[model samples]
Target: FFWDRGGEALFAVNHLARRIIEAKTPKETEKSNNPKDTLAQEGLGILIDINGFQKKHIENIHAIAYMMAERARYFKSNIEIDPMPAFERRIVHEFLSDVADLKTESQGEGLSRRVVIKYIGAI
Candidate 1:
């Protein structure tokens, strides 16, 4: 079920099947407000999921992984990335898990938490 708003307090909850509409109102609302962000989000979403949020998130993960892989190998030292949510930190850890010379760890607490990639020097 989805809510269709015509005005303040003038909305109806209607059932919708994914086959009926490729994009849901929630998906549209989620990316609304900022045109630049919406475009980027939609472009990325087309590559992955219809929501776009997941695709953009995955892109962020890939970007962080690329940086970590390069820095951990070249500098042979630990690198700290910007603070991210727990799920995002998990993505980084999982993405780098198979990297022979790279390892990921989470540090800090609450909203200040972030991931730290360290060069483990080949197993």
Candidate 2:
């Protein structure tokens, strides 16, 4: 179905899809040794990206991470990003992994978890 509500709608659909998949998955399959079953249990195997919205959203995330990293470096202080999902936090961490003068850490609990960019002395 076509959704005209933009990114918010896409996110909602994806979230609902994950929940539905989780609800339908068999409890036995969740513990199975098979890779396919494990993948299903993880809920990372299913994503419905409409018209590359996910890709564009990821790029926006990268841009935000870069901006935040620069702010941390310029201010020589730690910068806390708003809470985001694990996958998004992972993107921020990996995107900034190679910066010599900065470090990324995940903080907070559960849904409030977010990435913090810490300014370290330039190498």
Candidate 3:
């Protein structure tokens, strides 16, 4: 079965998140009966609000990497992100692959799998 034709699913998530945040929906607060299953069906992960008004697909690799880099630099230690789907994790890994002072790794198994960002040196 084909999932997410082109990048529509990701765009859908972004749109949905925006609507939810804007209170465009009615007061009933209609929520998906099975949020996870619904996202799976769309071949998408989660959607998170960036800043205050913008909603971004969880596959937002650059944002994730930047946050990781910031955390690692601030704490001077490895930073671990919450579990993400394989495709999303791959995005993070690939984006950080060329950074000289940062290293990335995927750890855990199944749904618990997540990404770890390590500070290798000053950049």
Candidate 4:
């Protein structure tokens, strides 16, 4: 699905679509022979976006993570980010994975889960 704008509403719709798709998907042994079904099963299903909003959102997330890392480094202490979805948290972790002086971790539960940038000292 596509939209002219994407924010909380778009996010909610995308999330709902994902949940519906997952609910309707068949089990491994009961997989369909159709090529389309195969593609969906392989995670190549329809994409929901709003004029490249997802890409822009990812960039924003990366920017925030970078800033947080800088803050942690400067303060020589751990910094906790505001809660975000698992997908977003993963982005933060992966983006900072190669930074030798920082460690990223997820804390809290469910919707409260967020990334924490821990200062591990310069290498």
Encode model 1's per-residue lDDT on 1-123: one tens digit a residue.
Answer: 111231212111111232223453336546667665555445332222333445565687879778777987899999999887665787788888888888889999998999999888877
Residue range 6-33, candidate 4, lDDT tens digits: 4767777778898788778765677998
The better candidate by lDDT, 1 or 4, is: 4
Candidate 2 per-residue C-alpha lDDT over 4-118 given as tens digits, one digit per residue, 9 for 90 to 100: 6546677777788888887766565348776766666665556678788788878989999999999998899999999998868988998999999999999999999999999
Model 1 spans with C-alpha error above 4 angstroms: 1-50
lDDT order, best first, reads 4, 2, 3, 1
Q: Which stretches of model 2 miss by more than 4 angstroms?
A: 1-6, 26-30, 41-45, 82-90, 97-100, 105-114
Candidate 4 matches the true fold with a TM-score of: 0.68
Model 4 clash number: 0
Flag regions of model 4 displaced more than 4 Å: 1-6, 16-47
Q: Which candidate ranks first by TM-score, i.e. highest?
A: 4
Model 2, residue 118: C-alpha shift (Å)? 1.5
Candidate 3 has its poorest 10 consecutive residues by lDDT at: 50-59
What ranking emerges by TM-score with the best candidate at the front? Answer: 4, 2, 1, 3
Residue 57 of model 2, lDDT score:
76
For model 4, what is the C-alpha lDDT against the true structure? 0.85
Candidate 3 Cα errors over 4 Å, as ranges: 1-59
Which numbered prediction scores highest in lDDT against the true structure? 4
For every candidate, C-alpha RMSD to the true structure in Å: 14.0, 3.8, 14.1, 3.9
Let me know the TM-score candidate 2 reaches against the reference structure. Answer: 0.66
